[model samples]
Target: MAIADQSGRTVFITGASAGVGRQTAIVLAAAGATVVLGCRDLAKGAAVRDHIRAVTPAARVSVVALDLASLESIREAAKQVCAEHDRIDVLINNAGVMRPPRSTTADGFELQFGTNHLGHFALTGLLLERLLPVAGSRVVTVASPAHRQGRIDFDDLQSERRYRRSAAYAQSKLANLLFTYELQRRLAVGGATTVALAAHPGGARTELNRNLPFLFRGASWGLARPITHPVEIGALSILYAAVDPGALGGEYYGPDGLFEFKGQPTRLESTPRSHDAATQRRLWEVSQQLTDVRYDALAKSR
Candidate 1:
């Protein structure tokens, strides 16, 4: 429960309508941070705000419409955020979808890759200026252990050649880490004070797995009761990355327990492949080309 006090900070969280995003928003709001819930569902977002307010009567909370499945929504959300807030202390790319039937985003990219990776890539690029001006600002992107199973198929990045739901989802999560490390590298090279970090919930009990195979979903639900903790616990890794004074850019954190399935947030290591510089660079370039949103600070600094 003891975490950094973000008393006067501004935190913008994506997918705050429910799950870990919602839990993180509440925690930050309770700590007196101005919490902006970026959600695609206004009604669900309102309910989350009400919950936060009920917990902390003086909570500073607001909601902006955001749909990670659409590049247009990301732009509008970023604009609304910048128009309203002078600075952003932290931006949490916490919203995501799990293994779903193969689909494409509004931008016509693979659903998981578009929403989970490209959406955030564009959002962060568009909002980098707002973060750069604020000392110690951080951007935390959520990855998953499933990332270990991911392989970036540049030839078929959208799974147009072969589509396996689980593999696609894993690839997207891997993209998150690649994006985080690449962003951190750019931020440091650009002489920017802001940092980019990544975290994983370590198998938290959330609705992200609702799209799994029905049999697996039913069986996992029963087994997960003992292995998976609640959203709050899963959210600690994110809060730690967002506010932990010792947290470094490009570092990743997750649970510290058995197989990293459940435990308190702790510094965790990702797969060796996730740290490949060449792949990271390639992914960054492709992401820029796909999303069409470039990080200006890096270019200006270069």
Candidate 2:
């Protein structure tokens, strides 16, 4: 059932302390990939490394602190990773915050959009050079079924207006899909082997939902109980996108069961809006302006 061993691969996964990212890291390590765990908290990252070692004594796991709320921290982390490794075979943008009390990132961007989208956007651009030079690197962004109901408000990408917590989150996740799609387009034009793809967990029980207010937490749990799959199972779709054979340049995947909230990894349709190349390109430009991270820099030499 697992894909063939990825013995020589190096994987960088964010939010590796717990939940889907943690489980996905462990699974990748078990598949013989050397995994770099990116965490907002160093101690938590170390604990994950130790736990992986306990279970798979020979697991190659390293921890690095990456605070998605701070662009400087993300830059430093990406720089350090590039300095240490010759190439990263896969980059999983799995770390993200959900519905935190209305707040802003270090750069003053709204938390959900900043941490979930812009942070990863900047990091990806920073590391694009390293990944593209490698033979077949892939970037996998974890999105959500909630994106189905999202509309990117160009007027207020940060939700500076009409900020409902849920809406902000939807916008951020929608941004994730847009970023993934645009990256794939650029990778193709640049003639790079590195691929960019998107996948969503479809409401598996992960800590991503932990930020919800207590009442909403209980309510969500009750509402999705029977249909919600285990976090570990939820990780399969991401892992599949990360290492499965014949992975495409721009594809979206989710659970193969009811409402895509449960069961095995399988192809799932993205909302028609998510497929709009023009909107994706516009969002890409806005992201560059906001984060001051540019993918075109990767194009300059090529």
Candidate 3:
């Protein structure tokens, strides 16, 4: 069932300037939740905030600058958030980059692996202490169906040796699932009320492809999948995971309709590798080592 009461709920979403995060913000605001839209560009973020305000009229909305490539920027964003809001009910790790070729982040990690997995990893870990005590707090993360083809090559997690764009992107997405599932397992063992759940948008059309070369962008924009699903539908799984009472912690969800690339929220199947306890644990350990942030320990400090 849907979450019926959200008058005072606060949702902090990364990449809120476009696609799933943007649409989810609008839907959540209408449901009476305060929405914080995190973006890398302050000006673009403001434009999204305006659109939200225009639609919800009196929508509790704010935009903050957040660049996932830099840890300093992530820390600064968290500080700004803590200073502005005492608590956040929901944290959506929705911002991600796909298939960028041969580039490293500010922290010297591969772009997709760094931005998609490590950035969100550090961000969530930084915010967990603040969220865990809130009782109903949930961290909703986004993964991808592309993860089905992923295998974590721990020896080359940064793709320093083999930098095929898709390989790196898929590996990072796989890391996201591993982190989400492991987070839930850890939280359960510790008896924390916080829940770690994930949702994937099956090729919903979003601006995530805007950075691609013109031909690819044009081809994607003209396609029937990402550009096919209405942004509203693209936001459904995220909205469902964020508020739906049935969305159990540690569970992975996706579009329930045909092939799981487009449809309503449902318990779509993940690859067997995603469910492998051994691999998941390995990913958790590697992620901890790479990001150098332990959310579990942080939760304990509180």
RMSD of each: 1.5, 1.7, 2.2
Clashing residue pairs, candidate 1? none
Give all candidates' CA lDDT scores.
0.90, 0.87, 0.85
> Cα miss at 269, model 1 (Å)?
1.3
C-alpha positional error of residue 175 in candidate 3 after TM-score superposition, expressed in Å: 0.6
How does model 3 fare in lDDT? 0.85
Q: Write the per-residue lDDT of candidate 3 for residues 168-260, one digit (tens) a residue.
A: 888888888988888888888888888999999876877777656665464356545443566778788898889988888988898876677
Two-way lDDT contest, 1 vs 2, winner: 1
User: Where in model 1 is the C-alpha error above 4 Å?
Assistant: 215-220
Ordered list by TM-score, greatest first: 1, 2, 3
Question: Which RMSD does model 2 reach against the true structure?
Answer: 1.7
lDDT per residue as tens, model 2, 1-302: 46689898999999999889999998888888899999998998999899999999989999988999999999999989998888899999998888788889999999999999999999999888778878778999999887887899998877777688888888888889988998898888877888999987766786677776664365346555788878888898898899888668799988989888888888777888888999999999998999889775468636
Instruction: Kindly report which residue stretches of model 2 are placed more than 4 angstroms away from their true locations once superposed.
Output: 213-220
Candidate 1 lDDT by residue in tens digits, 1-302 = 58667788999999999889998998999888999999999999999999999999999999999999999999999999999998999999999988888889999999999999999999999888788889999999999989999999999999999999999999999999999998999888888888999998887877787886564354245546677887889899999998889888989999998888889888888999999999999999999999899887557655
TM-score of each model, paired residue for residue: 0.96, 0.96, 0.93
Predict model 1's lDDT versus the native: 0.90
Poorest stretch of ten by lDDT in candidate 2: 215-224
